[model samples]
Target chain A: MTVELLDRKLLFVTGKGGVGKTTIAASLALLAAQQGRRTLVGEVDAKGNLADFFEVGPTAFKEREVSRNLWAMSMSTEDSLKEYLSLQLKIPLVARLGPLARTFDFVANAAPGVKEILTIGKFVWEVREHHYDLVVVDASATGHIIGQLAAPQSIQELVQVGLVRDQTDWMLDILGDPTRTGAVIVAAPEEMPVNETLELVTRLRDETVVDLAAVVANRVLPELFTRREEKIFERLPAAALAQAIGGPVQPLLDGAQLAVTLRRTRGVHLARLRRELPPEVPLLYVPYLFQRSHGARATHQVAEHLQEELT
Target chain B: MAAKKNPAANTRSIEQLVAAKEIVIHCGSGGVGKTTTAAAVAAMAAVHHGGKVLVLTVDPARRLANALGLEAFGNSETQVPPAAFVKAGVEPRGELWVAMLDTKQSWDDLVTRHAPDRKTRESILANPLYQNITGRFVQSHDYIAMERLHEIHAAGTYDLIVVDTPPTRNAIDFLEAPERMADFFSSRLLRWLTVPSRSRVFSLASRPFYSVADRVLGSKFLEDIAEFFLLFQSMYDGFVERATAVNRTLEDKRTTFVVVSTLEAAPVHEAEFFIAALEQRGLHLGAVVLNKVLPSSFLEKGTTASARAMVSGAESLAGAVPASVGSPELVARVLREVGESFLNFQVVAKREADTRADLSTVPEVVATVPYFDRDITDLAGLLELGEQLWR
Candidate 1:
């Protein structure tokens, strides 16, 4: 289905590692908050580098407002479990349950779906409670996202009957609804990321009830030359260029050629990604930024690009 | 070749490290070319060191298989044919073998090897929790990877084994996986969880924990978990001993870790963290291979000035060239585009230099692989990258 991504209450931003998944997530959250939506962006893994994107100090399980309407937090499974116990289970004495929780944490780690359910359950609960207009999760990379998205269902099947089993019904209701929840896969215009994006597209559809909202192709390189201009670039006389530039021009031209080749190579993969992805899933492109720094400035730059794309 | 600017900083080359170490574990955050780097280094060792070399990759793209000239290699090791090396125009001094970790297969193999009896083996194989652990647990991937490495090392087959770690949420997850696996098997929690259901429900000290767990998870599900762990408890000694052995293999003096990362902000931070992790654990950090580094050409003395000239004086400079090249307007545009591209890349290149300078925990060897215009999809290309690391 065609999706207006931000209209969805929940979005899980994920991709293969190092493809700017967190950047895309930060940008989407920033853009949503800029549009006056109360938004929460969470980093599922505890890399704790999410704050770098906003130039904010370290965030915690307690959501901190990084902007007017934007709040950021890092998911800690233990904290999530503690909250679940206190808030949902109505277990008042969290201090007394420390050993119980610690013991449960071991089971959650080794058990297949327990940790995933706790992590995704927190975000799903946020959406269900209307705590935020939108929640964007910087979810696990391509490898583990399926396990995470399908956690509630897996839990339902595994646990015959219990509080956790009953809990999955509502979480699944929110997660399974296309209007309320969708996944945004961020990919670079490279062979592996594109290949992974395509693979994940199929997996997300088959394995989980979450809808594929869109794919963000991040760091797309610019085309350096037009057909005619490329010919002109190729035919430029080496001797004249060297003399005119007052230095050897071979390395400079070679560098440009390298850029051209890199872009062209990435173009083929990008085309495959576009052609293969379901046409309804809008593909957003963000240009490769050669910016010197990569903190809040880069976040704003990405947000601007995303704003242009979303429009 | 770019002049070596920091020779004194590199006390030992990657080549020397590989020669001295029997096992080289290539690890870093994902998408930093860790798999390709491991393959390339193994290829180089097979060519130069003249003994059997094996590359154990957890998950490789199809193109990596093509790069090694193998249709596919799975749990069983497959030698990269001599013909494939010849096709890449190299005569290797030794054999290069490739294997991809099949987690499910490895888990089953571990079960078969460690299971106490035929009934226990069959029961564990049939256990639903066993299926879930093998199929979905992310830590299983990490533990199996290290376990496989230990198994292979113990086999005494290859002169050199280069393994690429699984991509984990945390960079050091696999480093701790073996110990964690052992701890999980021996932890009080497992004993408590696996305690007889009647006793668990009746015990005073555990009453509150059971009541909470029973309500939260339901008694039936807890029973299933209890039964699964009870089954697993039979193999506890085997698993713990094997995990301890794997940990020993990692800490072995003959084993060294080569952390690979691009100079991107996140990856470099992870690399730094991973290096510190290695140091803290007293694990050997043999070298750091920085992949996809921009060329130093952008940092040359006159290149920036030349690029600026091409941009600002494009029209006039186009006039200086032969008319046969193209219309002056097109030539000028081409010059501007090329010049602008150079400046753009120069910014990134400079950023890389600054990042490299700021890298505080670099080891005795720091190798940089320049950005390849194309993906490395063949043995020759792998060698091309290998040559840089070898230097």
Candidate 2:
């Protein structure tokens, strides 16, 4: 029951900036791949780190294999529109023509969310074509990506007929289907990110047809010591701990205190998060990695944790 | 003695720009604490330097709006409660103002000011294409955000204005939006697009493209777009004028652009990209503020070596049978964790420094602000961050 994300054909991973949203998206893709699903991880924005994280060269508009059973792409709205127009207008290079491009460009510039629609439409095509078992989108942060998700519906209202309306309807149908498509909101165990995540959930629930799947609580600090040990450690000030802990171990005790303080903050926030979010929206707490690097190993560790948790 | 270096080599902090420049625009990758840095700089200039400061944040979340103690700001500037400063125990010699860019309202204001009459404004505002662009479009906020800043700057109402460039998702495209805007407004193609169907004058001249677009997209979209442009026909020069003026303000000596970033590899890369983009656009990059950067001085080489030695010694000492001591294992474990934390902080610091080192090609002073344990929620918190910023 918990491995619901893997059952879906399309999964959108989004949250606030710097909250390890990309890490979670990568992990989810890995988890899908491990479950024997041929997965494609797509980054909607131009600024992407999929290549770096996978220790591969940069990905572009075209999908490239980053790992076993997994492929990655960083989609550009421009390239998407170019491909779209070339296909739709039946012209070899419709996007190259200044006048025809202007007609296509009008939607990008003057229409709200058309650029987003283009990007999503490309994914919709991949999903429709059944090229991959799952397509995971590393969308822009919560604030902007919400509008991107909603663009299909609004475009449906704007374009009343022809191939454009049919395409918009196709995207909307896929997005609205709970079993086919859903999105997870990733958050950090802190005030601002949590606040934004909560706001995003409510707004998304209200505005879009996509199901609010779950919340990925990234970088959650684990309680290292027992309750009794933590109390004894917590009561001692850094200086006192240095002496009481003894044996010239003052520096270590002081460092342990810092770690405790950080976890204490996380503990407080994590509790508040549980109390606030509805029980239906499952909370998946990714272990907080204390190390500095956010490389391939860290990403896969979280992926493994995700797999283990769902199991 | 080791070779002497210039003391003022890196003396150009962002705080100095607050005092020196009339306008300070903070540009950065998303989640690099750009809005907080902008607010911190504004509060410092308002309270410490006693300059009249206004902060215009493009944050859609209104995080800065909340931090500045405003419920929320609108297109028009709202003076931050001087009481907010007083509550923080700081008296300001000059006033502080804050605003959030409302794209639709600001665009309406632009039309209201430049449009010839009420009828034209109403039609343009009501047009579906215009409605979409003004309301929910992505990069539309960029040029409009700067336009309002230009409008406010021209009024000479404040000594310094701090702008947090909106995370419009496509920041580079947004930054270039005004040019896209100017091109659209000034283009003969748009003028052709604007031709009223009631007149047959240019209908024959532009039949090839016009008829094709009308046939392809249907009369409704073309009609709405053409009518929207027709209304803007009178106001096109005004739009172009404002764009040029804004670009001039951007290029002016009194205006400074500050690039903000966190220590993370992704953000650092984007910050470098931003700096290069600014340079490519003929805009001089003034200062780079690496925000949320880990403190490197905490564990210098000497401290690191000694801490490692101390931890290893403790492991050996704790390995010896405890003489009925309450928990020698606890001491060893604590020592290891402490050593680990120090080593962790060292790695974090080096990563942060490497990010800043990437900015070396651009000759700008790096202002490094330490990562905090909690969010800067209010003016008091912001003031504390300001101390860290200027420190």
Candidate 3:
């Protein structure tokens, strides 16, 4: 189904690791904010690359507004767990029995799905309670995305009934409802990423109930050559060009040839992807960026691009 | 002998590591092409350098499987057909086997092999309650992948076992998984949870505690935990032993870690953290494979001067184009498009080069594989990568 991403409360951006999911996620937030929405772009890992994109130092669990409408933070699982533990259930036990409480801590922390649940639960809580119109999660890559998306369900299954189960149920209500949540898979035009993106789609259909907002194809090669240029270029490999188009223009011819060839190759990959993916999946293309990594200029450029295309 | 203590140099290349190391693990954050890099290094080693190689990949999506031209891969080692190797122009003097980690099956195997007897194994594995408790063990993938690495290494069948690790949440977590596993097994809390005598504290501690737990959880929850512990308690020592062995294998000099990442800001930043993570653990460093980099030649230093001159000349020509053939507006538009793309091309190129320069401080050989014309999804494509990787 085609989803207008802005309408959804939660927008999760995920794909293969190097496919620029974080970049797209940042842009989505920027655009959402530009549209006057209070947007929170959450990063799951403590790595703090989002801060870099926004030209800020590492941020803690406390959300910081990096731009007018955009706020970003990397949630600490421990902090979330602490908040979770402080609720009505465990405060008495931890205060009374030190050793038993410590064991309880170990068991609570070491149990499978606890960390993931905490991370996701924190994000879902923001979506539920925060006044923000949009929450864009810079989720872990494809390998971890499924587990994160399904973390609530897994926890719900594990905890048949309790405060923990109730919390998971609330999180699941926000995530599993299509109108409440949507996903944008960011991918490059390359094969492995597209292959993985396709796998994510199938898993989304079968495993989760999240809506697919759009497929943001990041760093796509922009088309440059015309039919005439292409026809002329077909006969002239770099070697032939070097021999025939000698002298001052040789470097230009060479660079242009390289550019055209790369673009053509990317086009082929894009065509293949189109055939492979569902035609209905909306695709948003983000140009390859060359800006310095230390600032948010590239992100703003992408946000502007997102605004132009998304509308 | 020790990665030359220079991640900045090009001395200890990928080819050298594959030829020398008994194990090379290609690890990094997700989508950085670790599986492809590992497969390439393994194939190159087996076909060109001569060794028995087995590559263990943790790709749940099975993209690596598809890239290797397999319908699917499982826990067992599936040999790459001789014909495929030959077709990829790899004249193999040694065997190259591939497999994807089967976490569930591996978990079961760990339980069976470590259990003292068939009765305990059956009891632990079949326990309705303990099943999820253990099956979904914390950091199970990380622990299992490390165990499988040690298992294959201990077998001594393959000269090299190149592993493609699951994408890690934290670089530190990836490095510490085995230790964490050992810790989990030996933790006093685990012992308390699993041992019937030690388990009674929480259940029998106080009337209020017992009543609260029973009301919050089911009344039978405590009983289930007690029973599950009784069954798994016998296997604790065995689990600890295996975990220690796994740790030893990782610490061995014969084992090396390779960082695989794309030349992007976030991934490169993570790669830096990962390399440090390895160094902190005192692990052997092999080579870093930076994949899908823009080739240096598009506007490499040697070509930019003449290329810049030509682009200006073309724009001027666009200004003077005859109206009969095309309006100056259309010509200018085409020229502008090309100019825009070229600017983008240079931008991407600069980003990669800048990252590459930043990475030179890593003090190990760094291999830069240029963005190929197509996605690598077949054996031939992988062989092409193998060629570039070793070069």
Candidate 4:
């Protein structure tokens, strides 16, 4: 299915925790940058794994150049507050004064939506600043991302103030516009992530009017065994297999069985993914990279795969 | 000032313990009001009782930021909005502080602080393995977070400290962080690895081929270790000593460990494991905050119409139990059904809570926030959340 992902200013990637959303989001950003488009990859959680993937230690909340056309950052609420305070209040660290700064940190860290709103606010700022051709948000898990995206509207009803209200309104306008923002759900080709992704798609459809551009089925198992190869494994004498299990032949059998088990699991998950996903939403499947996705090399490989899909 | 009494407070007894500077932990399943409840309790202590409070959270979902009404938080302390507190009629007596655990940064800070000297710090920072281990390993991060908690407590900046522990799933890591760090420091293998000259001399004599193979791998491999040891040399003694102190502090009765759980099965199971883990570590379980508990009214309704329809739809289609029941409504119904079946989950949670000697009561259902149809974001949402929690 050759579906061209729409040209979007923002691509929001979210999935269940541990579903490779960050890796895929980085890949998408890298792919855009490789295509000669200036790109920024932002991680909402303060983990800053993006820098690690880029082979750097850690990027601050402020965007730092990673490559020729790529930049990365991990959003920090304290830094954002400092920026907000400095920009809005025109007070240099006075807001962080005795007792006041501590109190603010406590409240900011504890408040629900404050992190999401700030993270999103930062993304909106980056988008408006036009510093990058593409701004990719490595959002929290699917359920939380939905909550995070809904934050602006939720806060707008409450604050109704000067800057906070205006910021909320501006974010809402950007997120609500399909042309401006595109949300992609990333999932492993496993039961839990795929099931959660379907639920996420349904929830997004129900709650917000934003466009869910595609579903990226990550870590999909490629079909390596034929039906005849499966028959041969089945026909292997049980006694011989059990007796020789400690030898080289046993290891090969074990590998074959693992491949078969993985294939079966992948088949079931793929079928469900196809059935559950909205027909209109394009499904992009990324093969599982056998190598650990830690440094720049693996990220670049994943980006190569994403280039075709994004285009 | 006399303790301002309020019967309407969700957990008056719990609040009393919290106000007394007891270690109150707010934990639960994700999406529940665990973070918010923790923040409110800390706020209550700081604002009402004239007690300085520090709140520590490891919720990567950034729920604490939402609860505190801040745009974002870092490892550093930031201020809370005073207007909301004053408007809510809560007095500002003592101070409230917050820090989001940045595990890597904290670990680096610890390394820098504990390292014997500048050379040792530089060596440790230069080691690739050390960087990879600290930066990427989840366990390493959790251990550093715990180390930071101990440091903050020892600093004596706050009269009361409220720890919003990581979710129950990762609760074990947070609870055992000190011990893990201690074990890592004391590991025999690490000790052997640090003595490169001795290792190289011994390897060359005992296994010449292996030593030659090691040299072939890379000269930098040994250099990395030498640099690491040098950088970390100054702080080795201090790090081990501090780890011992932190371990002792954790084992003390004054250090309260609060287990947070939801009424749901997954969180309940997680809470059970957490309690067991804490007991094994010789830490006291102070209180269990059961968050997002469904009101008896909702549970009594048996199943929602949608859930009933799903069951019927399965029955009609398969004429038997379907291969899988995978709908949100079904998941909810199943959770409810599980809650009703053995009641074993809550029974075990309550039993565990009761067995804790330091705590005055078993698990108490403090505040039960109903599921709001809308998403919770911003300061107003958090204040609304505070109202729900305090109500």
Highest TM-score model number? 1
Provide the overall lDDT of each model, using Cα atoms, as 2-decimal numbers.
Answer: 0.89, 0.75, 0.73, 0.60
Best DockQ among the predictions, by candidate number: 1
Poorly placed runs, candidate 2 (over 4 Å)? A1-3, A86-104, A224-227, A230-255, A290-292, B1-9, B196-216, B302-332
Better model by DockQ: candidate 3 vs candidate 4: 3
Clashes of each: 0, 0, 9, 40
lDDT of 4 at B139: 42
Model 3 lDDT, residue A207, Cα: 73
> In terms of lDDT, which candidate is stronger, 2 or 3?
2
lDDT of 2 by residue, B1-391 (tens): 0122246646766677678889889887777788888888888888878767899988777777777788888777899898888888888777888888888888888989998888888888787767777776656788888888889899998999999987766556656766777987877667656666667444553644444444444566656667777778889888988888888888888988888878787777777778778877877566778776655554444556645754666556444424343366665564455566666656656766765676654655667777676667789999888887775
Worst 10 residues of 4 chain B by lDDT: B337-346
Stretches of model 4 off by over 4 angstroms after superposition: A1-311, B1-12, B27-33, B60-63, B87-90, B166-169, B198-223, B301-369, B378-391
Native-to-model Cα distance after best TM-score fit, residue B94 in candidate 1, in Å:
1.2
How do these models rank on TM-score, best leading? 1, 2, 3, 4
Measured against the native two-chain assembly using Cα atoms, what DockQ does each of the candidate structures obtain, in the order listed? Answer: 0.71, 0.35, 0.37, 0.02
True contacts recovered per prediction: 0.71, 0.19, 0.33, 0.00
Q: Kindly report which residue pairs in candidate 2 clash with one another.
A: none
Off by over 4 Å in 1: B1-11, B60-63, B204-207
Name the lDDT of candidate 4: 0.60
**Candidate 3 wrong stretches, greater than 4 Å:** A1-3, A87-105, A108-110, A234-251, A276-280, B1-11, B128-138, B195-229, B315-340
lDDT of 4 by residue, B1-391 (tens): 0122245334555555565544565654444456667776677677657766788876554556654667788888776767656655566787777788776688788877877668667777766656645653344555666677678888887777777765322557566666656665565434544566665566543543223223222334434444555455556678778877777767766777666555533355556766667766666665566654423332222223322333334223222222343333443333222223212222333343433322223433344454332334444554455455553
